[model samples]
Target: MRFIYRLVFALSLTLGVSAQSFAQGLIRDAEAEIMMERYADPLIQAAGLNPDSVDLYLIGDMEFNAFVTGGQNIFMHTGAIVIADQPIEIKGVLAHEIGHIDGAHLARFGDASRGALATMAMTVGLGLAAALAGEGGAGAAIMASGSQFATLDMLRYTRAQEAAADQAAANYLEATGQSGRGLVATFERFRYQEVMSRQRQMEYFRSHPLSADRIGALRRSVDNSPYVDVTDTPEEVDELRRVQAKIIGFMVPPAQTFNRYPESDTSVPARYARSVAYFKRGDLDHARAELQTLMDEEPENPFFRELEGQMLYESGFIAESIAPYERAVELMPDSPLLRIGLATSLIAAGSTEQLESAKAHLRFALTEEPENSLGWYQLSIAHQALGEQALAELATAERAFSVGNNVEAYQFATRAHESLESGTPAWVRAAELKAVAQPSPDEIREWNRNQRQRQPLAPSRGLR
Candidate 1:
């Protein structure tokens, strides 16, 4: 449930803008990320794309939507995962998106500037065309009509792209020995929504139009697929359910979570959900009890231990939190978030020995997740406690830079540069930060003008 706002710097580099301008609400759960990566890897590989080349980003939104941007990045909403009836359902969705990528549709659309718009006018607008999702009416209107005017052929283009992707998805699933039933099931649920007004329809329907022909084609593909009757493995099904449970627990009201998974449900996922709900409500005793039950059931489960540590730490039991966090890290050494948790607890312990330990864990964590702002912030705190002022400033600069606070980043970089020995890697990085953090001449002039405009006018013509 704890998420981070990740600005895809690559996007800015490709589109010629500031990454911070697009604070995509990307959830930073290591477990969820790993799960999604596992789900998409086969499809990605089957599409003739390197698994490592694709980045699956989990958007923390309630709407069932998914999008691909910056060529290799997949933005999937949590709601999509939550609503899926089977693992294949989500896979079908992924396969279709990958189809779009394999076709290079976005790049192609960007290339063809003329002549397509006229042909696209006959198709339904699907209002705002789904990918430009926002919370306001103005955003909807602009995306639906104005801002995306040039790409009005976007509808025609996307429909064609959708068909191509569907066929591609079917092929990918068939190649991977996976069922396409989930894909068909997913589309079937939305077929009727096509007639609804755009505002009333799910964003997925708006973005990925489901026509009778398209659905019929998908059905034929599904029926012909060799794996059509195959279902997810038992283990995969269980994991999917657990993931959905955790998502619902974190996303819904605590009371609703309790109602949905009442005390009668003694499953691990049910306990996990209840624990999360209790923690959110600040009923630490009940939360601890639920966690204890889970621990007693699965003594060596790292996620269970991680939740225990999280609960203890959030409840101000920092010292008590360390043991579970350390144990969790020992059990799940590959999880950067677990290491970060242990490091954070160590930092809070505040002893010199603890600070050194914290630094080591944070260094390892940064190796896995260099752009994590919270990890950098905690690392800076540890360094500051150890009197490593230059290192602390550098860490602070990285943290600020990651979150788009360029002014603060510049100040920290400057301080780091002033303190660190020249010619070292740290010093070189500090210099880079300083260079990137500097405002342009035009920006400086505009800032000065704004400051002057805000100054009190002389009382020369005052009524007094």
Candidate 2:
């Protein structure tokens, strides 16, 4: 398996200092964003939140999970994407996490806690408590000791918050015209897995604590909803699911995934999945062939196009990769990943003529998603290519800090600072932006506070 350990969790807290100080990997593929936006738009609209304001992250892990830290950022485990049979399931999971943010559960906890130390204590204690709660065979012994911590109450409260988030998810799905069935279905699927293993059962029971009655309640709510017919499914959702599958599946061992769906139509994605396997196995020719076949079948599939372009680029076919990447941008104009690939390929091909076009594409991509670190990075390179050192420095600084490349960020920030004519607004802004590259004590506190804002509300103690 092509595993990526320590995939940094999404931290979006508004601390006295910026979490931007930490390095967060950039997964800014045009195809990934396009997929994310498809599901994100509907969920945000349903929850009455601005789609543009929310940032979605795909964590490189095999665990079937999704969660939001104190920040409002939504995180999806790559495993969650690879394992899901359909795109709606991923949406169901994201919508549920969004429910936690919209419900302000974390904010409520912060308000209830007396201070930062107490909040940290509660956070750590709650994690331990949840883990202990999952120790089914040893539940009695664990709980006996677990109750000693003050956060036990808080832990129970967190479970309640999860339930409330569940209820809110149902409402969001129904309001948005998507079926609450997906949510219920996902829950039931987890519930089944919980039943199969004492460990999983304990984990779900501790964190979720849903009973038959609760599941039935959700079912009833879905059954009674009047807005069942209201939702318009975006074609992008399916495409995103396929893209998710391809990317994630490619990351995993082909045997594990192909074993489950040996001859399914989903095999196309599985083949793409195996292509990654081939690449990892150092069979570049086979990998290229597999991706090429996929591209041939779905010529307009930008994700496949991007992959083909990347394969060609990596295989010393820089010139050959350019056309596919250009076509990829034509297919998804707003994709930063494709633009980055195109720019990188252009630079590799040493085409000064394409430099202007590449810069234009990067700029357009940055405008669409300012936090796209790769776009800014590519923009800097493109600027450097055009003999614009000052602009390159500025773009590089912004790119560095936004995605948590503190060292490079600091270097770029300093370069940008030195390149500027003193006392100009550009210099001042660059300096301010650079400050965020390395988070200080105050920034951490502010980030913690921001994270608390997305937390779900604690369930009433008297309810269960």
Candidate 3:
């Protein structure tokens, strides 16, 4: 797991932070992503939505949250992943969110998730609980005072809407041969929140409006389900535990991780957590030892190899990290994360041949994940090292755009567009980025259709 925590969780009570800050708080892990997909694909298909069409993100927020926003996108907080005790619990949460997506519930939140402004969807969800989420004092609210209460008012769902989503979630679980018991159990856990003040309850409860009647409706569905007794397979359980262990290892303090997964607990998940804890504390020797044992036990697991590479590269053993990174990419060639890791290691090697190889790997990885700002930044490094100034400028522009820094992106893109031969593909790309960073007054775009007033149309996007 590449652990990253930025200003994503409840972002502070202050206002005026740029949309770019929202772009910076996404995390990527091959194992965690695949685990999410394995659970989501079936439920999405069951809900009559194309699994491929839906986008899932892992946000670096510590507060437990999972929400559906613009374009069938699901943003899940790492806190939510750690909070789920059972595999089915998270799936149930996703099923419920998908139900909201299926019903287009966000339409009521107002037509707010338009281009470059898609980051605002996150703000929309967070703003609903600003009054309570801030926890006290300056934590009182996250958005500006002017629009905060209006957002809260608009986001409050009707009881009927909540019930309909619950019904739909139940039906989808049944369709996918999943038990509704998990869904019912999840609701039951949150039922106590209904009686609490909104300021004292979870952000989810405030927005979803849970009630005893809602729990009863789901319980009834579960009681009547033919698959009520179905439980997660052993593989599913192991995967979930490992993923939970990874997030905990990254987010929790070393002492807390050690206490949670004591040394006597010799399970893979326990070792994984301990290794991450050690890594966090800069205990490279112990981290490597724990990981070596894991690699020996499961030589074919790509994530272990990726982590090994991460440990070595991040700790400045760039040369030694290359083999493991290459092996990880070999094990999971389709994973853009692994590929980017390999590219980073290759770039750090600093040899002419290694630099060329790094460029190739980055080209392929960026094709797979163009929104990865780090990859674009590295690509710029590789290009500059190779004396490809125009390409480096283009890569710089791309990196800037990926992070929602239009001013910098426009500056670099203009330079690239002027330097490159006009009408060439690279020049055209530079032109495109330039246009996005600062579209002229004459540009025609429906993306501008929903703006409160005239402003630059940021690309309607988010990175994960």
Top candidate on lDDT is 3
lDDT of 1 by residue, 1-464 (tens): 11232332211111101112222333556566667777788898899998877767665456687765535656678889888988999999999888878888656654343334333221112221121122323323332343333333243336778899899999999999998999899988778887898668665676577788999998998899778999999888878877777776667778998998999998877888888788777798998898898799778888778777877876889999999999999998987788888898899989999999999998997877676666787899999999999999999998877755566678789999999999999999999999998756664565455445546573233111
Q: What is the lDDT of residue 237 in candidate 2?
A: 49
Q: Model 2: residues >4 Å from true position, as ranges?
A: 1-26, 110-159, 192-206, 227-241, 257-267, 385-387, 404-464
**Which regions in candidate 3 have their CA more than 4 angstroms from the true location?**
1-24, 110-154, 404-407, 421-424, 432-464
State the lDDT at 11 in candidate 2: 20
Ranking by TM-score: 3, 1, 2
* Poorly placed runs, candidate 1 (over 4 Å): 1-5, 8-24, 110-157, 403-411, 432-464
Q: How many pairs in model 2 have backbone atoms within 3 A of each other, for residues 3 or more apart or on separate chains, i.e. clashes?
A: 21
| Cα TM-score per model | 0.80, 0.70, 0.81
What TM-score does model 2 achieve against the real structure?
A: 0.70
Provide the global lDDT of candidate 2 against the true structure: 0.60
Give per-residue CA lDDT, model 2, range 138-193, as digits (tens).
Answer: 32233224332223233322656777777788788777667677667777776765
**Clashes per candidate (backbone, < 3 Å):** 1, 21, 4
Q: What tens digits encode model 3's per-residue C-alpha lDDT throughout 1-464?
A: 11221112222100111122322244566788888888889899998898867888676556677776556777777788888878888888888889889998877565542332354544543442332223322222443233422243335567888888888888888898988787777777767888999778676776789888889887887778888888999999999999888877777778999999999999999999999889878898998999889999999999898888877877889999999989998988987777878888888888889989999888897787676666787889898898889999999898767655566677789999999998899999999998889843332232244232334456533211
